[model samples]
Target: MVVQRLQAAALLLGPLIFALSPFFWVDGHYGITGGTLIALSMVPWVYGLIGEYERLRERVPTLAGLWLLLLVIGMFGSIAFGLQGFFEGVFDITERVSLAALDEYPPHSLFLLWLPGPSFPLALLAFGVLLGWTRMAPRWVAVLVCLAAVAFPLARVLRTDWVAYIADLLMVLAFGLLAWRAWHRPVAAATSD
Candidate 1:
């Protein structure tokens, strides 16, 4: 259970941790430390989320699993969009950055920081309403998570960079709640009888 929460936290933290990379970039090399941790943290997130979603499918029987894949896609799209700078080394992201200040940032990848944060939450909204709120997912929790997506992101958007910082904090809370619910649920034996 702790492992599951850590994995969920890793998924959310991967991007937030990246935001803090500036402080650790020593001598032009973020080093194996930052690079490795960032890279390694993703594995468990993918495995854990996919595993949990699959289990949810067994218990619930819906296309929620595929929608989770949609979340993964938007995540990668945001990552790729943000990394428009790194893309410049091999291809041309100049058009992508047009007038952005990061056009000249070295190792030239800082532009990846620009990935859109609100998209995944929005995507989850549709999936949750269609699949979970009606019958499968814990109804109240599903509703709250979706609402948190809108409220937190909207609050941030109205204020600019506030969205990124506050969104990270809120996401930590959301994942923590998932962990709590998953952990505290009655054991299967209690239900099977």
Candidate 2:
């Protein structure tokens, strides 16, 4: 019961925090405050993702497991990215200099940034589809989740605040609905899976 509540809280809060982060961005850069929020958001986001896996695992064990794995990998990459922003803000490092330094380490760059980065959105896309397929959520919820998944990567890559905001809003709505359902569900039903 406690775990369910925690997961629900995480689901609601994680994306909310992340959505608010852009408000802290200054001069086209995530300052220390924004970076910190991004990093912190990942903690609850991870918990929420785990809870999502738990819900889906009984219906589709293999796909759920893969989604969880991908999400975790992508989370590590996100954390690294957030920390880089924090450090850059603290040290007054330019984006060009930071990218140049990171380029010097090909393996680190590939594993930490490039490879795992896409996994987050990809996993979300799969999760959204699975939610609809398994009848775990409404069709509109699934659609919103998929939209958010696609928007997330594009928002970051394009550095578009409006798109990011939209993605964040979609995430909040979709996850918020899931959390509400989880919270209101009978204990037996929640545990049965």
Candidate 3:
């Protein structure tokens, strides 16, 4: 009971914190505060993912495994990306200089930024589809998750505040529904395993 409520809270708060992070940005950079928030947001996101995996694993073990793997990779990459702001802010390094330094280390850049960065949205998109396929969530909720998954990456890559806000709103709506359901209904009763 307590665990479910906590998970629900995490789902509700994670994206909200992420959405608030943009307000902390300074001079086109997230800086320490914003970066901290972004990094912190991942904690709940990870928890939510784990909880979700536990819920779905029995029904689709292989697919759940793949989803968990992708989510972990994506979160790791996101953490590194978020920490860049912290490091830069702490050391007073310019974005160009930081990027250049990363460029000098091709493997680091590839694993930390390029490869895993894109995986997050891809994983989310997969999760959305899986939800509909498995009937774990409503069709509308799954569609919203897919839409948010697509919009999130675009908003981040483009650095568009409005788009980001839209993505965040979508996430809150979709995930919040899931969270609410989780809180109100036990998974065992919600699905037939």
lDDT top scorer: 3
Candidate 3 residue lDDT tens string, 30-101: 789888888888889778767777877978999999999999898877777789888999999988999999
User: Which regions in candidate 2 have their CA more than 4 angstroms from the true location?
Assistant: 189-193
lDDT of 2 by residue, 64-140 (tens): 88888888888887777777778889999987898899899999899988888787778888889998999888888
Rate residue 101 of model 3 by lDDT.
94
Best by TM-score: 2
Cα RMSD to native, each candidate? 7.8, 2.0, 2.8
Candidate 1 local Cα displacement, residue 156, angstroms: 7.4
Each model's TM-score, in the order given? 0.52, 0.92, 0.91
Lowest summed lDDT window (length 10), candidate 2: 184-193
Order the candidate numbers by lDDT, best to worst. Answer: 3, 2, 1
Candidate 1, residue 81: Cα displacement in angstroms equals 3.0
* Poorly placed runs, candidate 3 (over 4 Å): 187-193
Clashing pairs in 3: none
